[model samples]
Target: MQPFMNSPENYHILESLDSLVQSISENQKEFFQKVSEIRDNHYTLVKSYYEESRRLIEMLKETAFLCSLMFNIQDEKSICASAINILRKLLENPVAIRILSTSNSHTKLEILAEESSAAFSIKSLCTKSPLSCIAIKTCRPIIHSPLESAVPCPEMMESPEQYAHICFPLIADGVAFGCINILFEHDTDIMLLKRNIDLINILAGYVSLAIHNNRLIKTVKKEALTDKLTGLPNRRFGMEALQNEINRSKRYGHVFSIAMVDIDHFKLVNDNHGHTEGDKVLTLMADLARKCLRNVDLVARFGGEEFLIILPETDIDKACVVVERFCRIFNEASLSDVLNAKNLTLSGGIAQFPHDGGDVLSLLKAADERLYLAKNSGRNRIVAGKLN
Candidate 1:
């Protein structure tokens, strides 16, 4: 019984099973190949999406940096510089070449910043530039072909032969502060400019806010340092100025002088007359001191009836001469008619750098001591020199 080994039925069954196994193996291989192709395609798509997202994020970061540059700065000139820098960055496009700027309520448009091969005479933009005028008037952004339009700006006329122009208004709170003009080659993709329109608008808003905030800060700072009644620097500002002078003198090894001045019989005047007259006297003293001192000198109201004057590059002797000259003029002046008093006089004490004292506190103390000495010795005299 070599048995059924040679049976045709068994052989046929074995052949059928072999065929089925081969078929299953081929189908499995094809399924794995299809899965691999799908995986590759998915990876490619993910990579593309990630790269695009990264690029967009970088652009947004750049925009944020530009806005920060505009907002963080507090000076008009610095703001202008920032705006120019942004223009330079935006102009990095091969198509963009020039920029112009103008302010609201201004008749002339100026070439703020530009980068081009040709010399541009576009110094001013006339009202005839319909694009810029419309943008400013509407407080909006406009895109147009400058070459075809009636853009009477000399700069635009001189601009590259074929170009597109974009004008954006810097507006905040319903007020247009300024406008920015940009130039691009005619062949530049309009879609690209359209894509950046929102970003440009955001930058304009930041610029407007920066200018407004800078002005407000300047006004506040001036008010902080100034005396309301005398129109002189207040004590706080005087102290800061004195410290600065000290630092400067130390650095340059130069001599400077400071004086503490007091009005003679100020209390008596305040008592006899009303406070209104007292205020007037103070104001007059400030004006007189301002007139007497050189432009390099600084005068500040230290306290009631007391003023501090900082004289740069002056010695004790020169300070004494200056104070004496001022006193003589003040005493001889027709102040009686204004004050309802026969005479109005001033007393001052001088302190020189490194001679009287080295630091602000020491110098102020020394000057104040001499001022007391002058008051004790005589009401209307100046005391200067090293302490005895």
Candidate 2:
């Protein structure tokens, strides 16, 4: 070992050892730096994942609550009120609902229901043209944030810059019939709405479905209570109206009147005019009765050729005025063309609550008796009581 250390090769071996140590030191520093960077990245990823999971769970909870709220409500107004409440809770702002109605085959946009806290009218925000609403036109949601430099939609521009507007088109089965409009009183954070946008969308869908189902229910109920041939309320509905009037009169100590009207010799007309013409006469009578009666009055088809008329807050004398007016109108209307006779006329009998009878059957029986008297005495007149 001493002999080797004395040679020049010893110096070269020491230099090589020193170079190897320096290279190892440099590589160790780089490896530790890379490890530190990887640790930080993993923490960031974990934090991001946690945040996302929390948001997803919150969204699921909100969706479940909304579905539960919309489940049992059958009234359209009640459904809208529930929807507005949930949206207000979420955004801490006022909400409004607008629905589409078709009349005479024309679609009309109207505000069906809204919250009282709403600062602006739903009609004011919506223009006459449905296309003006961006959400409705595109069948998508429009989010106007305080952070945005420019408001994209004109409807959103109607609100002050300090207020954030969110509009979600209520679409179901590819039909955009309505929208849920929220006007945030404060400058809402864009992320709050963005994070819950899907929740809002699901809410909109539930609203549309609920409203559609409600309308179907109402239509079915209306059809059930209405007569198909004469387009008037049927006997069952007439009885209901009479009972309601009786209850209201009894509660308030007021008086109401009911009139039993019968077409003169309706059986003879049907036998002679072949039922088709008889139907025409019935329709004509309904139209004429509607013209003669006031808005508060209810005229329903009682049976074959008879109609029941309810007059609220009226006495026998006032009810006679109404019955007489109806008789005049019936006489003046052209009935000869359908019946081939000039004798077609109307006979009516009037009865008042608490005066004629207390209950529905008693009042109906009294009215029927008077109606029989009118028919026996004269076919074209009204009977209020025992003929004098």
Candidate 3:
């Protein structure tokens, strides 16, 4: 035996083992390359998603400012439109459809606005949708999967694919004003919505405050222009309206008339029956004037026991007829008993654009001069037309 270790058989066996080890090393190198490529692709996807998220957050901030602008201008329609536009932008990914829901006084959730592609039809949610009810009642965010639960409405089931639904309640000061619903198509990253929950909540806050402030502004404006006692436009508003009508007449060449009406023996009634009864009489007169005038006419309280009426598209002749009818109606009404007097009557003076005088001041002066004449001529009568 010449050195068994140097035998050809043994050498061949050693060569085979070395070849097997080399093949295993090559396979391991190829596997690592595949893993490295997969990791690079994942990182690229993550970077793209992050950039998109940052863009959406910037948009949300801009939307908040837009809501502020709409509130400042008191444009309710623009507010809704702006909200829809911002929502469409923010929900580009994951979201296939969006719906804005507002609670009506009738205790029903009304779809105020919506934005969606043509492939999808916007449908009303079920009245008994538990998820929506819960979100509203809790004033918090609710998320659910329509495929796993029955929370989805019939419209949501149209796709029959896995989808995520989110509802964010528009709440401020513990009051739920409304909710925003977002529907996500299949394979959407639920994490995206989760990450933006805080931003969405902030947007909801902005919307709620805008709507509340707008309503408050409207109420204040209405109160400022209205007479507290008689519920008619006050003298300030009347003056402004007169100026507007003057401009309109000048621009359009349309005729309009003004009547300055005074209550006869009004001071005596106030002195005898007290200011409370006087207030009642004023309110009664306002109601009578509003009821007797045409829908196009504007009646306003000029001052104490005085009313200014604007008759658009009417010449002096038609204005006189309207005023005469009002006089007859007031004289025949049962207001005499309310005033505790023998007769309650009105004295009116009429002035027409271009006919009596041009411009607001001229027309007002001419009407006032005639009103003076009516008071001097008789306690109950009308003074109209030019004086020679």
Winning model by lDDT: 2
Candidates 1 and 2 compared by TM-score, better number: 2
- What clash pairs does model 2 have? none
Candidate 1 residue-wise lDDT, 1-388, digit = tens: 5557588888899899999999999999999999999999999999988986786677668977877877677767678667666756644453443333453436555544444435333334333343446676777787766445545334345555676777777666786645677766677776667766777777777777777788788889989999999999999999999999999999999999999989898888878987888898888778888897789999999999999999999998998998888787777662567666547888889999988889989999999999999999887999996678
Candidate 2: where are CA atoms >4 Å away? 1-37, 92-108, 114-123, 131-167, 172-174, 181-192, 335-343
- Full-model lDDT, candidate 2: 0.79
Residues 181-287, model 2: lDDT tens digits = 77664556677678878887877888888887877788999999999998999999999999999999999999999999998988887788788878888998898
Strongest candidate by TM-score = 2
Task: Write down the TM-score of every candidate.
Answer: 0.71, 0.81, 0.76
Residue-pair clashes per prediction, in order, are 1, 0, 0
CA lDDT, candidate 1, residue 136: 68
Instruction: Note the Cα lDDT for every prediction shown.
Output: 0.76, 0.79, 0.76
Cα displacement (Å) at residue 290, model 2: 1.9
Global CA lDDT computed for model 3 = 0.76
lDDT of 1 at 381: 91
